[model samples]
Target: MREAVRKESEIFSELAEICTSPGYVHAIASLCYQNNILIYADKLTPEDMLQQFARDILVRTEVSTLIGLACKKQLNIDLPSPEVIQRYIDKTDSLLKEIHQSMMLPMEYIFDSNEVSDHNFNPFRDGLVLREPIFYSGESAYYFQYRDLSKIKYEKDNDWFLRNKGFSIQQVIDVVMSIQSLQNDKAKNVLRGLFDKNPSEWTVLSAYKFTAKEVSDISNIEIDTVRLVIESFVSSIGMDEFNSLDDFNPKNAYPIIQLPEDEYLLFQIYSLTQALYETPFFWFNDDKAYKNIANQHRGEFTENFSAERLKLVFGEERVFSNIDIYNSKDQVGEIDVLVVFADRAIILQAKSKKLTITSRKGNDNSLQSDFKKAIQEAYDQAYLCATLLNDKKYKLVDKSGKELNINREYKEIYPFCVISEHYPALSFQARQFLKFQETKNIKPPFVMDVFLLDVMTEMLQSPLHFLSYVNRRTSYGDKILSTHELTILSYHLKQNLWIDNKYAMMQIEDEICVDLDLAMLTRRDGAPGSDTPEGILTKYKGTVFDQIIRNIDKLEHSEIISLGFTLLSMSSNAIEMINNGISELIKRGRKDGQHHDLTLEISEGGLGLTIHCNDDHESISRPRLENHCELRKYTQKARSWFGICIGQKVPRLRFGVNKEYDWVQSNEMDELVQDLPKPQNLEGKNKINFAPATRQSKKVGRNEKCPCGSGKKYKKCCLKQEWRM
Candidate 1:
């Protein structure tokens, strides 16, 4: 008895618990059988069994979600949120319900070849061998197709179906049987409403006009037997039991009883036989299935397989090596991965997907150009090693100083892919393409699929897969264009139009000859012919090339011509503008035998301004094109007395001269003083030496009194000016 209890076979322990707690006992028995464990041997109670089932549901859901997250992280992909996952689960469950409804019909109706009136219809022949309904519905039905059978299809019986007035009695019986047996009556009616103009209203429409007694007589089964059969079938088809079988108490359990033992007995035999038939398919697994199985036992398989694959591929040496990563100045590019070997550097630019390239001349063909341009653009912007600054140093520059190689021709360049978890096929395909390129020795511009795949698998694990390297010069270009260059270019174009309009106006002035509006106008003899504004502007569009030309003209004509020339190197737009404007201006200036000395002055904070004069003299000049406008060049004298120094006892660093001292000693004094310094005071001074002895000085005397009238020492008081002041 002790040995028997220790073994706790299913029959003994499970049946024994039926007298105590049937529901818990049944669940325990099912779980024990599934796991090949003995529940009684472990002394599992009804409460324990129920808790275990709940725990299992939670565990499965958790494990699935965790695996999903891991895959997403590995591929650097964004996974759907928990709410989204929940929605997907709900949708899957809904679809399962629909499948179950389709599967709930009787085997006779599902596979019968006879007409509506045929008394003999066999379901077992059409692979509807299962007497229980659970084998046919929802996830279980899906499972069956994969586990018990290789395929499924409905056979057409056109002759039989046509003869039944487009309505087979068997089809009606099947639909009613499915509807009546289903616990979800709402779903049942909704399904029935889809098929006919009218449907009978009844709780369980198993038959028409026949009472339970009459139906039982015809079917050779009791009412309870019929109900039990439906319930068992539903269970077998993967429908969860809402209530335990033992809890099912029919109102008329033995009403019209017939073939009582044989019915249940036949169902049991069918269930056992089907399980036996599914054993081979359920147990067999291919590589794909093995992966699923391995994932299920992830705790054991993950670490071991990781190590094994690493050993196989990389041996003992670590695959990753460290290198310096600099913050790229260019916003449009980043360093996907950097590898430095003895004589070369490998830079990878990874993308989420590959562009589709075509050879035909069409929009799709532009993908090749786009691909080439993108890679070249990224390369152009990438930081060149400071040591490798000039092409001349590498013997790669021609005699004319042009680069001998295209930026894309560098062997170390690699463009890889960053991918989502579901795109393994694309990754694999891209890898094959890259490998093809490598083997064929295709040039740098060619897109290779193999390198792309490797990059996708290896580098995409990092969240920052979108990063690329951008060169400092191009980064500066981006800043310039976004700020000053674009605006200035546009302004130059506007100014050029203004000048052209003015020139046309002058030409029209020369052409017109009229006494008044009442008289007919005639062109003045030998006067410049006027051109219409539209005619002059007709050929021009605001294209980059046109802007370049206009900008050059503006630069040459600017009062600060040299400053405008310097702008050329600062920005590409500036360069284009300067070239066009300066070339034209220089040609015209040479013809006129005059040139403006335009120079640039840069302040401490890098603010630049242009000063222009007719010669080396530091004075402002008017340009012919600028409406002949002239403005004075004066050093802005400090308006307050605190900025100038003159005479003893004079205000310390005051802007104005002392009243008691001779005004002749300071230039500032000469400028500030009114009248001829009083005629009496000038009479004593030597007339030959009386050139108003004003001298300019940058510094003031400290011995002078405070300018603000504070009695303290000059240096200690107002002479020590506040910085903000």
Candidate 2:
């Protein structure tokens, strides 16, 4: 038998194509007219279909606009009228909302409890770190370390820098004022004097050197308040909060140690200051300390996010994240996310790089370099991980480095690079590169832009459909192997079994088991006396019968006979039920007697059933007909009974009765008798006549013929007409 084919999403692909065709649009319009739905058919032209609808449809326009904006305003398109655009935008937004509501996964939200710790930098113990020198010119009155104060003024110019560092302009002002309010009158006056001299010329360490007593003498404020104010100002700059004025010295000071809240505020100030002082700050800079940290966190977030999305789409059991694969040679690789289906594996590599179109014309050298590097790195890592999976000897481990034992082995692996940002030109280039790689026999990873990933998570609910889409997009080879076939292959590979022999044996066993189970269910005598074994067997002759007969040599004879008997027992019970329901026929078989001669026997490479009786001829033959008819009626309701006999011959025989008991004859009986071998003579014959009695000495009437079909009159023959009534 030919194997069942795997289901494909060809219809969806075809629909996608048809949706873009002008002819299809026209046909749809025609359908609307036929249905009496008014449409502006005359206004619909090939150009209108291609330009007006194709390019300007609500969903397409909204998606394109999003992509364009994401790519740093690189994409250029003609704008439609505001009214028309707004209408489409609203429609698109509504559709998206509906889709999201329908497809969102029902996952329980979990709260993270890890606290954000403080980070601080000090010029003294932490070393004077200058991101870039504020001034490189000849020496001035202020020392180089004091120039760090220049950052404070620069922070006021860069709002975005502050926001990125987790702060607001108001928060910054509040923190500064809070520190100022802690200072006493004398300390405040000293601060004012320092600012007037040159706010950018004084370092925190230098301010710490001025004694509170000197400040108190200068401003005539309380000495204790001055000391408290000086200590508050020092602590604000990330100094030891409990340090004594006598122990503190500008020459030997502690490193800046920021408290959790203070660290966050200071980092914001420092970042904003750097941004404002620099000539230009590249948004996509790879070297910045904060950017590097952000990228690490973002990459982790992307992996987790992708895993969750996959879990929603495919279920949690099928998705594994941060899987580590290592060979004996110590070559190691990690998969960001692995989605395993019954027969396919999807390996995802999440890249946190911010992709942008540096050149509108798509010829920017730096953009091309960055895109290629990212794609290549992701692909190489994915390929390495896939290679490990291809061999059963190497196991893929979870994040904790514990081996994962997946029951199913994949026939196909789809590697995808999921990017954080949209870069249309780079994406197109990546696709072309992948296509080129395919020619070289390397299955390159597909580039999944964030938008496309979102859409796929919504659309491909089934893993089979997801794999089908991947195959179509990549021009992968035809999907000829079934899930069962792949399962067998997996077993063979894992067990190191001979492929040809084991696969064939497994296939045969599978077929036999399936056919046997189906036959049993349909032919069994269960409640609802609606079906019979014989009818079911006959219906499945071409399919189930052919399979059994072809593989009979491989199957055990006892097994087949057991199945046949099981079917017979069920059928017999069902027949008895039907007999009870019939008012005309009394059932011959009894529970107490154990004399049911109904036998299901294997003969001549087929199954046949025989029934016997030792009663009067009429009682035996008439009941046979009733039983046959009743069984046939129930069997008619059955599904299939391919290997069992349901013909008229199997039910017509009578054993242990004399030839005189042959009172009924039909063409069906003749055909059945001709097919069977010669019957054995009975060992003990006790024939009892059951014909209705007649008056033995009745006088013959003149015109009546013999009752036995003789030509002579009743007086001439041994018949009496008066006996008929």
Q: Judged by lDDT, which candidate is best?
A: 2
Give per-residue CA lDDT, model 1, range 399-473, as digits (tens). 343333323222232222222111212211221222212211111222222212322222212111111111111
Q: List candidate 1 segments past 4 Å from native.
A: 1-591, 602-725
lDDT of the structure predicted as candidate 1: 0.25
Regions of model 2 farther than 4 Å from truth: 1-287, 355-361, 364-367, 435-444, 476-725
Clashing pairs in 2: 536-640, 536-641, 537-640, 537-641, 537-642, 538-641
Q: Write the per-residue lDDT of candidate 2 for residues 545-575, one digit (tens) a residue.
A: 2232323222323223323222222332333
C-alpha lDDT of residue 402 in model 2: 82
Q: Per model, how many backbone clashes are there?
A: 35, 6
Q: Which 10-residue window of candidate 1 scores lowest in summed lDDT?
A: 513-522
